[model samples]
Target: MKIKKKKRTSLLYQTNVEYGDWCLNHIENCAHGCKYPCYAMMMAKRFGRIKSYDEWINPILVENSLEILDKEIPKYKDKINFVHLCFTTDPFMYKYPEVVELTLKIIKKLNENDIKITALTKGVLPEILKNFSPENEYGVTLVSLTEHFKTNYEPYAAPFEERLKSLKHLHEAGFRTWVSIEPYPTPNIDPENKIDALLDIVSFADKIVFGRMNYNPEINNFKDARRFFEECSQKVIKFCEQNNKEHHIKFGTRYFDNKNTQTLFNKK
Candidate 1:
């Protein structure tokens, strides 16, 4: 797809699965090339009928997106409570620094206009957090602390320890930090203990979002997935509540039921 600026359909769009106030995609493709099935992957499978992730995730720059965003912001100035950066692609992807720079420039413009911006990614760079204002939220995506699991699933992205370090750095820098435990994998051993350690690093974050693994027919043995997700959610939510930290449960058709999911989504 060609990269150019254009008016987005909605200045404020609902997050499909993950937790956040609203979402925006500053770029067209993601760089991480995550091994697990993601929203983008699912879409690619639906339309292109493409089997492999590599064939679909050719990261492209959306040059026109920023200009379109600049014009679109004013239209929903009153209703847009928070703006999420790049829902489909990781803004901090190694291949799109220039595009990410432009994206951040637009975010700064929105901030100047009194709009709040939040971002979620697995490829966060420390320098990016330095430029973010207090109103900007920074969320890091995590699933397991085991080096092997991270290497196998999120290979192209930063290491697990590096991500934790980045989260701590962002928190210390005073940016509102959050953690995303989505696409939780089913492992031979229970990872609840590992999650506690990961949460310890993110304890300073303002909030945490927990989402279950997406159900892709190609992936098998998903029977235990929902149970594990609920367990993880209960553990994290309880921990957050005990520690006086904010947390939310994200739901989708593949995992938790819609009615039960709303309990957290309805919150402010």
Candidate 2:
């Protein structure tokens, strides 16, 4: 899909999150190419914004993104509840060197204008994230610790160890750091005990956002996924509680509301 370069009247795009007000997607289509197979890619294809795997592999940098943002940020600056960076794309995607530069520029500009920003990525953590500001919140998605899961899924992204190190770096730098295990590749990455492997890095994170894998049933090994994920969520809850970490159990992964248990039986 081509980059939507046309200048917009607004860059503070509104969306839902845990008290999140607006978001910005300076780039579209992540170069990470998570083949779990990426749900974002699936949605983009469903809507005809992206039509092929080859196109998904090649990311597009939104043209005049910062210029458009400059025009829009002032309008929503007062009402902003910490704008999130690039939900449709990785704000720190390093596969495209230009995106790395753009991300840094955007963050720096927003910080200068006192517009709080939060971002999560499987990509690099540039030097700019070390700021002492209370407004900057940075996060990384460390879904699994195994190299196999990463190579098979997020092939073009940074190595798992590097990603963890970046998260730790930001956390220790006194920046508000968070982690996402969303679409937490549970039984998909480890058919044996996915939650244990998933929570191995919980201590490094200040906040954790996790949810069940959706729309990738073909790759999972859970016999009764809904029940399994509910159990997994329980484990995550316990782990986070014991460690005194803030955690969010995203929708569809909640046991109380899971509605796919018609033939549910544990085969694990």
Candidate 3:
């Protein structure tokens, strides 16, 4: 893949997600080439940032990210709680040393300002990150353990075991670690997979986030999609409770019965 560079006027902004963290996307496009209807790609194309999936797989690094960040830090530092290393792109994108180097510098700069960071990636986390602030949290996205599923959907992202190894390394080193099982496929995409198995594999994480796949009509093709996600969310809550692991179930994944005035599972 050809690595390209671009300049941006600014590099930091606050995110309005429920978690309410500031976010920075130092790269445009992603090498992971996720096919779970990558929302980032969709948005990028919609905005004319890129024209096609073929172009999307070759990432464009923000050449002046560090320079831009230096200027913005002091202005937003006080108002910022923590900055997510990316909402629209992966920081530790696999096989892209340029992306990783820039991410390291970005993290160091943020830490120097006493700002924490939260990052989630499908790529392998580098070990050098262990030397950074332990307060910063690192996470990986693992929705299924099967190679068949990964090869078909995630394509260019690191293998599941490789991603898990890096996450577990960070966790065992006393750094905060988490996992995101998001845009998780239903039977239509992963027919023989089980959520519990993936959960068990990442049981070492300090927190687990579960959410259903969206956008892709194929997932909706599953007749029991609603119940499937509801039951999966309940199972995730139960597992987290029993293992003493923190958990977050994205809003739509949890179902409520207003007519009965009861919830099948307690919200976490």
Best by TM-score: 3
lDDT of 1: 0.67
TM-score of each predicted structure versus truth: 0.81, 0.87, 0.94
Q: Which stretches of candidate 2 lie over 4 Å from their true place?
A: 1-10, 17-19, 219-221, 257-268
Ranked by TM-score, top first: 3, 2, 1
Candidate 1 C-alpha lDDT tens digits along 202-225: 777777776666654432565566
The C-alpha lDDT values of all candidates are 0.67, 0.72, 0.86
C-alpha lDDT of candidate 2 relative to the true structure: 0.72
User: What lDDT score is found at residue 39 in candidate 3?
Assistant: 91
Candidate number that wins on TM-score, 1 or 2: 2
Model 2 lDDT tens row, 1-268 = 2342334345667765442567888776777888877777898999999888788877777768788877887777777656778777788876666888878888888878877778888987876668634568888887777667777777888887777788788877777677788767656465443567657765777777777777776535556777777877888788889988877777678767643332111111
Cα-based RMSD of candidate 3: 4.2
Model 3 whole-model lDDT (C-alpha atoms): 0.86
The total number of steric clashes, by the backbone 3 Å criterion, in model 1 comes to 3
Query: 1 or 2: which has the higher lDDT?
Result: 2
Per-residue lDDT of 4 in model 3: 94
